[model samples]
Target: MSTTAHSLDRLIDESVFAGRIYLDGEWIEGGGGEIASIEPATGETLAMVGVASAADVARAAEGAARAQREWAATPHPVRAGVLRRAGQLWEQHAEEIMGWNVREVGAIPPLAGFALHVTAAECYEASALPSAPLGQVLSSEEPRISLAEQVPVGVVGVISPFNVPLILGIRAVAPALALGNAVLLKPDPRTVITGGVSMVRIFEEAGLPAGLLQLVPGGAEVGEAMVSDPRVRVIAFTGSTRAGRAVGELAGRHLKRAHLELGGNSAFLVRADADVDQAVNLATWGAFLHQGQICMTVGRHIVHESLFDAYVEKLAAKAESMVVGDPAAGQVHLGPLIDEVQRDRVHTLVQDAVAQGAELRAGGTYEGLFYRPTVLANTPRDAAAYCDEVFGPVASVVSYSTDDEAVELASATDYGLSLGIVSKDALGALDLARRIPTGIVHINDQTVNDEANAPFGGTGSSGTGSRHGGVQANVDAFTETRWITLRREPGQYPL
Candidate 1:
């Protein structure tokens, strides 16, 4: 093994990556050819991961289906114990996982560490799900008792994105498993090792039964196979809006349960009464965290005209001050995007906005995949940067003359995932937050925020459904409620 590989082995169990796929309690070489896992920071081939063919997906689905009944029959406490152990294991190897995230995903230490912590926290939170109230007793008429009980929906197919692979995948996987559903996880091709292999090893070490959680590493074909399979009852996905729409449509056609946590071009509105320094800090973190590749990254900043100039100047300076470089080398506030395609996409959006009369106020240069944190001012409403999901280290400042205009500009986008409001008056921010159509709204904070115990999702094109974080997080998504009633006495009838 190379030095990097050897170092990684010391962090995580080396056996986890011995083969490409983890199916039926063993590692196996995939039918599909190998894929090169490239480190975005240095543009080097990190490792070769095996890709799963459609047949591999089919077999994994079959294994999950076969194991679903026995796994579901296990006591809830037993399931919770497994999840709790998995959380402990994650905590033990967190630094290693964080390091892998930095090297593989180009995530800054803070963001990478945050993702790792959240991933483990999700497991801990999900441990309580099996013991939560899954049903209720209702008063019934005509001398009868009515009761509703929750039951597992059987096998689930999980498709996660590359941006925050561990947390995104575990957000659904941990909950689904806790609720007695088998999961066939298909991680993003670029992050197969950290996203798929590592997770599988953690669960296995936690004493989960064979075939309960399967990892199939592959491309779009594998995802399609899992979605089309009749045995797979639910699909939990996190990715772009376009891809989520396709998955949603396919699930609808198949009449399968689907939970989608999709894209977002969230807005941050700075009221005239807001503190400029505080607002600038929130804007900087919201827009440039993870190079602004996050789904909830702030794409537009709507500030009152009175404070617009000051906000723009301060935000520009803040963006300019961000450290951008290889995340594996040293400390950095901003890191590279996933690859060249994403870098070019962000650059095109910025260039187009400038061409359309938007001023490039701060940073717009790049070295390889590392695009500097960029701030734009006076961006036209029709500019791509303002109208679309940039999904990069770019934020646009648009001035609003009135409160109505602020809300209007914030709601003008086709996506309505998250909204951030900064104001001195808490009541006023809350009042405005109600009027916004996004699924999640934060007062006096940034749009890019999440917790393991709160509901996290969006509206309009952002997501097809919501996924909560507490005990009830995946109950609705992974289980079906059955209503039952028993008659104490027979009804009178003429025979």
Candidate 2:
């Protein structure tokens, strides 16, 4: 029960660290083997998590389906109360939650705090959904009362990633559960504690009924099993574009609705009229925060050709000035990538870009998993780092002469997740922002931003439109509409 700073040994109950899975109201070993949950910053095994097998996925799904009837019939205020309590619990246990976030997922304190704040807000926002308007009266040509109503899609399957695990997992889980649908969460195995275990504890303490929300953490096979389960109706998936495609395809094959929040190679456009220093600061944060693993990270810095030199120079200096280390040890601007695989991928992209004639303005190295903030100038369009979603702390800067050219360069990517435009004339920036087809756009700001109630998703390769936030989007995502017609008595005219 150590409550000291950076002390994560007892942040969670000892039982959670014993490698159990939460299923149908109990924490027990699933039908699978064990896997070690490692601390990426120190390469230490945090816990031995018991993996979930295909059998476990089926049992959880079946339990959720059976329990959903009672849950949906529960009073709306009671369901909403559970969500509100979960929000309070998240804040009450902030220290412990943030600690696990740092060690398990490599989030700096601020990033971890952001995850906590957003997830709590998500619970609060979802609370209102239990009582939201779910149906509408409609006119019918026949002598009957006609209505269109929203009903829970029963046993939603949530597939969340490691980056910002808490927020991503809860954004879907909270809303779906609040709306009376049972959930089967399949978090990335690399982040089971923060993403999966912590979630179960929160909702359980909040008084949610057992079997309503199950936590099954494992690899892709587990997710595949959950998706293919007939009891699971909708799939809410957040991950890379490549993986998202597979999930989408599988969900489609199963005849289920899949809400996909995929990857991004988002752009930050700096106009010639913008203040160079201010733009550089925004750019640096956009590309370096959370080691640039965010889906909305400003991967491509489209700078005005006139200010390109100064932008590159200042960005390079900012990158070099940043310190990368274990966040739990001390204050550092950036932390390690999730694991060695990500580290290798990020480093390889940076090196390949440099080898392809891109000028390495700063960085292109790593010490353990802590990759330095990298900046590349004049990166070729074909370079992997420039065109693709590198998912690293690497900035690819390219010069654009006109607004149209900037729009072209920004829209050329397969992703349309997020966009940022900075200029002295705010109206001008807003006008230019409209030209780019991103799901989220920030004027005079950076790319990475999220709010609990905002409609948050991207077009194109980024995701399946806005399916994660807002009352309308969540209702549309987790529930389906049914047309009902009622008659006082049987009235038949046809023979």
Candidate 3:
């Protein structure tokens, strides 16, 4: 793998073009025409990547289908090693990876670096799980029959989004491959330069066979086409709720296994015993991390009545202190919100929230892709910002009189992805965790931060309610279980 120019603060095209889809372990033009990619920070044209028609998707599917059997046949350790080794290669090229993430996707420098590190960890974690299926040791009086195995399901289609490009992108590819499933990854059109090409080079460097992993970059057309392909056995997606629904529908048409990490408007709780400092830190992280585009970032909070006013004060203060500018700026808090459309959408929500009686506690400025980090409190329960997902640098706050009210308010949203419960009372927090209608819960901490091995996903509109199973999810799919009987005599049994 070549070292990228390592352009930190500069935009270098590298003679790249839009619609330049990656497929079958090769970079080539799309079967159709070309499409343009742009830098969200400057609105400048990036390049024209090749556009893949449905036919090209079909070809890729056939390729994966043809190649998957042997990969599925690969042993567990070898599969796991690929991920660990990929992590090694990723570390060496971390700067290149981080730079592209910051420049292409508009994440501030520090957060982008963290994203890279987390992605590397995730890759390795996916490799370490029980590569083989967990077995059963049964106890019987006579003829004992015990059987268990995990088998690969075949080719998996991975479609990731721009916000947590690497985090979401590698989730499917790393594990699917570890489990012996060939992968066709469709990264966000904006981030191929970061984990996109760099990743392809990484797997090759780590000794993964050609065609085991492939990258296809373009718009939704190529991705949708791949999802609809019959050869695809598992579909892993991370993006908006709307898109997840669409993918689920398409997969349902074929009875395919669909894994989705979809929309999130997570809840952050500030219990009376919460450490204000820690709570403030995570709230800011949620409000501005990746421009606050994370599905699990705390978008709303139910602060205990006793701490509500003081917590809002601290939260607003933190929001105002953030620096917004070029993503390459080392000390910048949050970068722009991907593009103008998203930034404007955030702006509208802020304005609407204020109009509906939400106190504009902090933030509401914009410069190009950069929307000021904002916080809102006393928001009307019915306002869109309070009820919907604002994929921008914004947070809405409301208060609760008691633990029950906080839990009720938190679960009111249709999205049940993640919930944060802040309380010193261990029993109360555990009780809250069980009562909350979310797939993942953060007790006495922020509701974000799932590592590679952690089974991550959402419930209800938050997602399809399926556990990603992390690294083991796909490897387990690689093998299936069967019952074997050892007879002491003929038909001797305890039954």
User: Which candidate wins on lDDT?
Assistant: 2
Error of 1 at 22 (Å): 1.0
Higher-ranked by lDDT: 1 or 3: 1
TM-score of 2: 0.97
Worst-scoring 10-residue span by lDDT in model 2: 1-10
Reference-based lDDT, each prediction: 0.88, 0.92, 0.76
Deviation in Å, model 3, residue 208 alpha carbon:
1.6
420: Cα error in model 3, Å: 1.2
Clashing pairs in 2: none
Off-target runs (Cα >4 Å) in candidate 3 are 1-19, 46-48, 129-131, 134-146, 469-495
lDDT at 75, model 2:
95
Per-residue lDDT of candidate 3, residues 208-271 (tens digit): 8767776666677877787888888888888999998999998898888788888988988888
By summed lDDT, the worst window of 10 consecutive residues in model 3 runs over 1-10
Q: Write the per-residue lDDT of candidate 2 for residues 1-495, one digit (tens) a residue.
A: 221112334436744545678888887887777788899999999888878999999999999999999999999999999999999999999999899999999999999999999999999999999999999999999999999999999999999999999999999999999999999999899988999988988888898998999988888889889889999999999999999999899989999999999999999999989999999989988999999999999999999999999999999999999999999999999999999999999999988888999999899999999999999999999999999999999999999998899989988988999999999999998888888999999999999999999999999999889578899999999999999999999888878
Q: After superposition, how far is residue 381 of candidate 2 from its true place, in Å?
A: 0.8
Listed per model in order, the count of residue pairs whose N, CA or C atoms clash below 3 Å is: 0, 0, 23
My TM-score estimates for the predictions, one after another, are 0.96, 0.97, 0.90
